[model samples]
Target chain A: MSHHYIKTENLEYSYYGGAKAIDDISFLITHGEKVALVGANGAGKSTLLMLLNALKFAQKGTIDIGNTFVTEKTAKFIRQKVGFIFQNSDNQLFMPTVSDEIAFGPINMGLPKEEVERRTDMALQRVGCESLKNNITSHLSGGQKRSIAIASVLAMEPEILLMDEPSSNLDPFSRRLLINQIKSFTHTCVIATHDLEMVWELCPRSIAISNGKIVFDGLSKELFYNQELLNECHLEQPYLAKIEQMKEAEKIRSAN
Target chain B: MENLDRVISEIRGIETDAIDRGSRYRINPASRIIVCFLFLLSMLTFSVFNIIDTIPYAIIVILLTLLVNIPLSYIFRKTKYLLLFVFFIAAFNPLLDRRPAININGFIISYGWLSFFTIILRGYISVTAAMILILSSGFIPLCRGMEKLKIPKLLVTQLLFVYRYIIVLLEELAQIINSVKARGYGKNKFPVKLWSVFIAQLLIKTYSRAEMINYSMIARGYDGDIKTFSENKWQRSDTVFCIVSILIIGFLRFFRPFVFINNMF
Candidate 1:
């Protein structure tokens, strides 16, 4: 409903014993845009997502999500607009069954039983969980669990979808299906993934992180070709991009 | 193929499980508690002329245990373990009389020991009956059945918490074992002191992890109790199941049928 979906000004967060997780980062995300957060393990991607949810407090600087500054009251506003997807969907899908997990958020919000049921159905339908309504959540495959996890948050009807490592551990086919699901959503999305192809396919903009700092934030293609930047930060240049670069060099050599 | 479909439906579908047979014996958990008392009291108050009384009650309780689906051995094992606390209860039955010579066959020995054996038999039978009731109904449906009978939500919550968290703790313990195993500490590599040391480390790790999870759950707007969305309408089958169990228990309790020649003894 509001203009700016998310805005952070010089945001900094440190874990216990003064281990900085997000070091002086700032960004404004507009509504209806998709951004990929590209980073290695311990690169503070999940930390930043946690801050957006008001699950973790900012140690320094300001985060304003939907006109509300990130504070104790931030939960009221942030939770309505921001839906967080954990990397291990296993944790999110905690209920005995799929429909139960989908209904969990709505029920916790204390909606009418009828409305909760309706929301549960609608959310499951959105995630193509029609045949799985009665299936126990634990029995679901890795990718299926991830889909249901997203559906659970969707039941709450949050405006922004912030996911951590969305493509991790999914088979190639399931990964393709997940990308399709992401493209279907109109909500503003900040997805963190190790899959370079996924970032290219699903995210128009990409930001790279290293050692608790945003090392690169640019258009996806620009970040892809920045070989020196990638090498310095211990990121392998995406294979497709490297091949393309080699092809370009070959073409130039032949022309010369 | 037809038989296979039937088999699959029976095993796999929740719908099949939901079907209810009409049961006259579908007593509320509170009523069931009263039933348990009536069962024990009537059996105790009845005048027994010989082995007929004791033998019949034992057989009836065994049948009930079968219906309850609790293994007889499981009941025995639990009772055996519980003997520590009640070991003195037997002494009172015999110690009050000190030592009286009792005639057994032809010889007379210590009468106190006979009293003690009676006490042990009585305790064993009583615990087993209770165990059968618990094992037959299972914990959750029993809780639901109790809830339907207007048992307070607070009491039901206690049962739910125990049912849920015990399993979670067990699973977490398993994961801790796996992570330790993955770190080059299998049966062959285990050091002498590490057993106690690892357990201590696990305690600390589980405590901190629990604290973190508590924070995360709170952030998700989890107030004291989580709501379960699915409260299905009780099937006719559930009613029938309850009824069938009740009828069998009732027949075994009050009726003095000499179907077994062993009952004569």
Candidate 2:
């Protein structure tokens, strides 16, 4: 089992007394693969991401992360291996201060005091938030909170990163910074997002889901070009892809 | 809606005061808790008729409030709402016990009135002391201090959650109220018919938000135990402060300082 490898088979989940959120989802993400899980709202993108990390257990299916199978017993171990960044940074950060927020995961993992301090500092620096170490988590701006949320999970040193709508509610600059940060990570990342431009840039492969089922699983370019699939999944083509299309059309017109 | 906003901001302000390092009072959290507990206990020991005797406790609370650099007005503002409830509870005391206790210049003061005054005084002192403790040492440190004092982890965790989530809850509530007002349902007062529906909606939203927060907590490898990055060490100043506070509290509990002062005057 290669580290950072994630595979889910026939995954299914349903909210209590509610409709199924995920149905028969199957995908294999190899080590260091950057994959985008895109779908319409109320689709299973978030649930699928949760299942990958075992934050939400599947009603019926199997999830394999590296060598460990995700079950109730292995959920703790799975969390250590997979770091989840929630869509709402507020929900992700609960600590009083930034340093405490970052150190929380490491400390909870029972790391030694020195190691916890080292990891907390390193994570703060990683997120370029060293100056915010003492700032209150709730008092921080939206971008700062999001960065700290990422740092908080990064402190645990997980092999796989699962982010849900990482770009939501962020300004342009913050979104670009986040994109660059995610781009630099070597760990396998599965981002569930509606940001098509982000998917075009960061993810080589994109998986589109509609009505709790996988509609398309292929390269991002192919998914973007399939207008019917994009419409069905409630996705817009990336602006960059549109630019490329216009450029191609311009060249053909000149040749004619 | 404005009141809710003020409440939230006031809570945040107190939280800021607790975590501020520039404040002169930096007593260890555990020592502050101990001193506060002793102060409250001493205040509680006074009988209802011993209103004058409770004066020393009130004075101590005022002095401590000044020492902690918290403004008197700020304390008054934070505790005024609570004091109103205390007033209601103490209002019955004067009505229930009408026996004459003190006579000054032939004007009679009933034991009930004295008890009422004493209850209000006690309420003010108790609340002021608690405010001082929290303002001196922030919420997280206070929880840590409580844990050090052998308080159960479950209770400490609950306290911390309530403190943290109160802000979130208030924000959620503010949004609901704003939306309601935007829809022009109630400009002066909330519509009575919408109360049940609004409350049910808030409850459902709160439950779902709680579920999300719980998931976030578990995703971060949270076991049953809550841990902190900063471990507070007991210091010499803490020990000295604790000893002096306890002695003062004990002296106030035993000696009637207000009566002595009155006699001298």
Error of 1 at A7 (Å): 1.2
Q: How far does residue B163 in candidate 1 sit from its true spot (Å)?
A: 4.1
Two-chain DockQ for each candidate model: 0.32, 0.73
DockQ of 2: 0.73
TM-score of each: 0.74, 0.94
- Candidate 2 residues B94-125, lDDT tens each? 88999989899999999999999998988998
Per-residue accuracy of model 2 over A101-148 as CA lDDT, tens digit each? 898889889999999999998988888889999887879989989999
* Runs with alpha carbons beyond 4 Å of true place in candidate 1: A1-4, A244-256, B1-165, B175-192, B204-220, B232-265
Every model: Cα RMSD to truth: 7.0, 2.2
| Residue A109 lDDT in candidate 2 | 91
**TM-score top scorer:** 2
